[model samples]
Target: MELCFGWFLLVASIPAIFAQDISHGSIVVDGTMTVAQTDDNFVCATIDWWPHDKCNYDQCPWHYTSVMNLNLSHPFLAKAIQAFNRLRIRVGGSLQDQVLYDVGNLKSPCHPFQKMKDGLFGFSKGCLHMERWDELNRFFKETGAMVTFGLNALHGRHKIKRSLWGGDWDSSNAQDFMKYTVSKGYQIDSWEFGNELSGNGIGAHVHADQYGKDLVNLRRIINELYKGSQSKPSLVAPGGFYDEEWFVKLLQTSGFGVIDVMSHHMYNLGAGVDPKLVSKILNPDHLNKAAYTFGNLTHIIRRHGPWTSAWVGESGGAYNSGGAHVSNTFVNSFWYLDQLGMASKYHTKVYCRQTLIGGNYGLLNATTFVPNPDYYSGLLWHRLMGKVVLNVESHASPFLRSYAHCSKGRTGVTLLVINLSNQTNFIMNAQNSINLKLAANEQNISRESFTHSLKKTFSWVGTKASDDALLREEYHLTPKDGYLRSRTMVLNGIPLELTSTGDIPSLNPVRVNVKSPITISPLSIAFIVFPNFEAPACG
Candidate 1:
């Protein structure tokens, strides 16, 4: 019903078959696809523990105290965790480098968050109580999240000369923290050193040799402490903006195998609050610029470590906090989903979204911790996409950006086609429509039907189309009010909202027959699932 235009009513009153002759142009697509040789972990999100006081701002909804102690009892979080079974969570941010573990609860007293000119401050000098650390570990275990803890790399180096190589750098505090973690039997998947201290630093800078030395020391400590275990947690370094020469030097000096995951931070879209944020996301050229960085990182990593994987340590689109309304709304998904598609193609093993619950760009709403539009996009991605990345080429207009991957545990491929055009419609050829059965487990609602029916069922079976045609399941993401600029998001015409009890609403997609070629409207995104391709490698 949401797809019907008012003008189409009079036209629909006529014979259903004639309606097909009265519409927009069609763009034929060639579905022949190829799978990449390598496939890495697809999605990784972050839970920022720094600036724990971000909640003090009126625009920020996350309270450091509550987020640090979040438990599985929160249904919203529970559902998200359940969806991404192997979710990777990075647990630190800017303040991490300045923070110290108060083993005895005797560091500086905790202070209220202060609003700095750049962003929120005050996470720099507080002590992380052993109790809070334990609680966070408990929550991680319950959620089955693979944890990557960021350690303080700038601790003793502050107040020292910036050019000095190693005198002020100390690992005693880190050693103590590792010992405590081992004693507590908490398993960390990776331990990252420092926070935004790379290119010219974010208030602090450490030379490549110095940082490499620190990473080597961390590796030694991990080997010594976890020697008896089967596998030790990985050592991640820099955790800052990517500087071509700086990163290459760090990897070379640190030597092969020193860092398991080469991580970097990105805020290429500028500020989330920018008035032209939506325009920027829709621009394919603007979105494609980041590909250079992605390619560069992958090239350097392969050249140096050869074994190390590349990751986007933190990315929230805009910096100095995100855009007020733009980053949090349905419009943001244009950038978010495009990033997901782009990053995976460039061989980024793990892409961590900045702040799981803070600022304006968080996947969950700050106050209620409800699932945002991006959350559902990520959920659908987790459920439908497999590890194998596929190569797909579209002959349609540049506005239609399409990506394909093998369907998760299914025989066919899943295509994610996004329409950036605000006014044009693109159509693809189809043989016969397959009626989708509304299984309770399928997560789609069958009650909401479209007012106008597309029943022409034009058949054009190409050489690519097998005698045994495949069935498709479509999950479309559009604005709640059908406006490209609107913030609210709906899936298959169903608006996603939090229930009265603060629970996650049923994210049921509307099912339809794909008997004929389907039309993709402007400024919308769809995940079309084609089952039974049975690609040899995906299985």
Candidate 2:
């Protein structure tokens, strides 16, 4: 998809405040709040299920042997996996390679195959085979998730030479494990030959040309082995840091048709960088720039061959230590939504967030699977939004940014408005009949700040000691409501009132006789779904 950004404005009004009592506006959506989906209108997260210190490489290993081995018959894990109809699992990391060498009886002395300091088991000497092929097969069968295996491609003994590229580069043990995983009906969507080949800056340095050749050889082998399959797993190469030239050359030499998708990595914040600036990197504007970069790279690839999709295979809001402040807050939701909107606008597909539940950027707290603010946002998105984008137009309003999309069945439309200005008000005018459902709160409110038990007061409503105490207490009290109110506003000679209800106490979508300008408050997000509309329905 082409990624481009442009400013737009809408100015118009109509008559009639329309309302439909039949509840004809019900709409369904998949609102997963995943950056990958935002980047590409597709949502997927990475899964690494290894135990801590179970295999030493880098970072703490995940300790979940029992969890991983749970019976597929159980509904909890199975249901969770099903919710993720389309998921991607990266099977190898530094730790994974360590496990492979120490556990698998690969005969070769590949770089990754060599035993390291404090090795758990003698690699060349052999150790217990810990390959979890059966476990993985059962999991995928139960969850319906796809796998992307990262094979060891380091130099020295592990490097798969031009002639031996098709053959397993690692010892016999590793090859057997690879073949076994594939045989168990596990579908491999993509195979990244190695991890961050360009960024690591060390190991067997394979230039773009070399990498491209190796990729071709791997693809040939995979295709030959699975000849009857209707689709071949994409051969992804250069799994590295951004190198436009290297990527372009690889595409040119390999032929565009040979590759399925181009992959790269991006971390907004790195070591020594100020954490306070983390929000800026995660900001929608910056994410737009990243999308533009993706567009530009895709354009370069298109020059050599037909179009190929792109993916930010690995990325998070932060890198080194994550954002000191903003990574875990409600403000991050803005970043998450903006990223998804921009990515969808550009048509990029398949965004894979770096970590699902670890590190600072994780959706859940590293130790507790309890969701962070970002996770809640993700859950909402996955549960509420649809896959397709809709066309929307907004008038000039510095405080509010809006997006519109029709539901999958074209029965309803969802309009999303985000108010970024801290103190400004936004007035919105609808040119047609529509229904709105809004979710809003003060810009600074924390997830834990409000609970279901607390009663909320609106800025516009007045309170009385009792229903009949208006004259009894002689007290004039401010309204407990927090939303703006309008009465009989005229637009093109039609009347409308900005009203509120119990469901959305902070905001209201009033029926309008004419599409007149409606105001929005600072730092709020609103959604209006139009089930059916006709001109001048209210009048």
Candidate 3:
């Protein structure tokens, strides 16, 4: 009677155990449903348009004077650059418009200008020397970064007598700058005309039609200057916040094939010092707010500029510089990784993070020059994610945001799962009779011993796998300890740090047996790679 009662209890508890309010989701990897083919140069960073003196890493024992002169040759920065294969560098920001190119040999290297009230905007009306430009080019050449130089277009704008109306701007100074660029034998991949001059604008405003006309003039000059060259660089424009009507007008006026990449800036968080910055990052809704802009831009591009690719030219999340501790810590990865996944899903070709070496949000610390938590997140994405994006659906909880893509060169798919809930864990499984049964049993049994064993399940419906082809790899990104808001990040329980010799440590992922459901802890992000599932669609 005792044995029979025990057996009966187990059988009756099956449904109750699995039915507990644990969120259940599924990832549908239908080959027919395809997202955009992500660009090989998808992960990009930036060097602000501001001068070196305005933003400098602390002079510690390392004795780094200026970021402009920071040894790109250093093993640390060099290796980080090389890891991405081809990381594009957007060398411009709010200050690009106020900067002047000094082609003449001037004895005074620094041409001082008034500091703007916003401290970070405009290069202080200073003259950037030819020597500095050359050094910058060398750094680019050495780092294998595709350079996009934002030219000073606002300097040429005139004060027309029309109220609430602006005239087409001139590009004579830009023309001179390009001519000098070609003469110096510096290969600029693209020339961006302006910065933050969109919609109502930031520091300065320009009418959309006027900006379009300026782009046409710049395009003509680029064509003429690089006539004999094998290939001319593209003309990128209006790097600023997305204003739908203004952007569409810019596209319509510029016409087809003029603007190569339709780019915009994103600083969703109102300010860097907002008291609720941490809560904002932790909130899934706040982080996913960018979807509106990404979706809107994609639609506009497809409607008017079908050939032009969409890109987030500069995104630091919080404007007026980023939050000191919040922007650079492990918690930011929740937003950073989610942004990458969301942007890619919405067909954003390139997502350039703001201030690669300056500000609090930089991947590398401004003072220590050390790689922050976001740096590893970027490196892992580059190494694990591929150009072909696959459809992923997580119906479990709003907190569990999922993205999938065919492994870069590997056979199966790589799934990026982000759990936004700080109090809930998640489980990811392949949706199949065999796997589902196994997952149910594992969850029911594991819960008996482990208090936090009830994980939100993500079941995927795709290609069938052989018993032998069930091997998977998982890279879990979380805080060094259990704390969600922290400065350090650990992958599979190991913190990624620079060696004593300033070298990148090996980022090893935890191997998993795919037959068993994978678990993702709370407030964490995981990259699940299925290498052995040879899906025909992925191929």
Q: What's the candidate order when arranged by decreasing lDDT?
A: 3, 1, 2
Better of 2 and 3 by TM-score: 3
| lDDT agreement with native, every candidate | 0.69, 0.45, 0.73
For candidate 3, list the clashing residue pairs, or say none. Answer: 95-122, 426-456, 427-456
Give the Cα error of residue 327 in candidate 3, in Å.
0.5
| lDDT per residue (tens digit) for residues 169-254 in model 1 | 67787788888999999989889988887867776678887888878888888899998898789888788999999998898878
lDDT of 1: 0.69
Question: Pick by TM-score: which candidate is best?
Answer: 3
Q: After superposing candidate 2, which stretches have Cα over 4 Å from the reference? A: 1-41, 49-80, 88-105, 108-131, 155-175, 199-205, 269-273, 278-287, 390-401, 404-406, 430-528, 533-539
1 or 2, which is superior by TM-score? 1
Instruction: Quickly count the clashes in candidate 2.
Output: 48
Clashing pairs in 1: 1-450, 272-323, 273-323, 411-533, 411-534, 412-532, 412-533, 432-515, 433-514, 433-515
Model 1 residue runs over 4 Å out of place are 1-41, 52-73, 104-123, 160-168, 430-470, 485-487, 499-515
Tens-digit lDDT string for candidate 2 (1-539): 00110011112211111221111111222122212223213565555433333332244323332223323454434444455454555554333333343234455443323344543233322222334455656677667777676665542233354322232233344345556556766677777666665532223335666667666766666776567887677766555666777777778777746677677666644431454554464344554566656777667756764556666676665654245345554455555556555555544565566555544555544553444555434443443345556444554543345554443333444555555554454554443212221113334555653331111121000111112211100001010131111111121122222123211011123332222233333444444544432112111
RMSD of each: 8.3, 15.9, 8.1
Sort by TM-score, top down from the best: 3, 1, 2
TM-scores of all candidate predictions against the true structure: 0.82, 0.62, 0.84
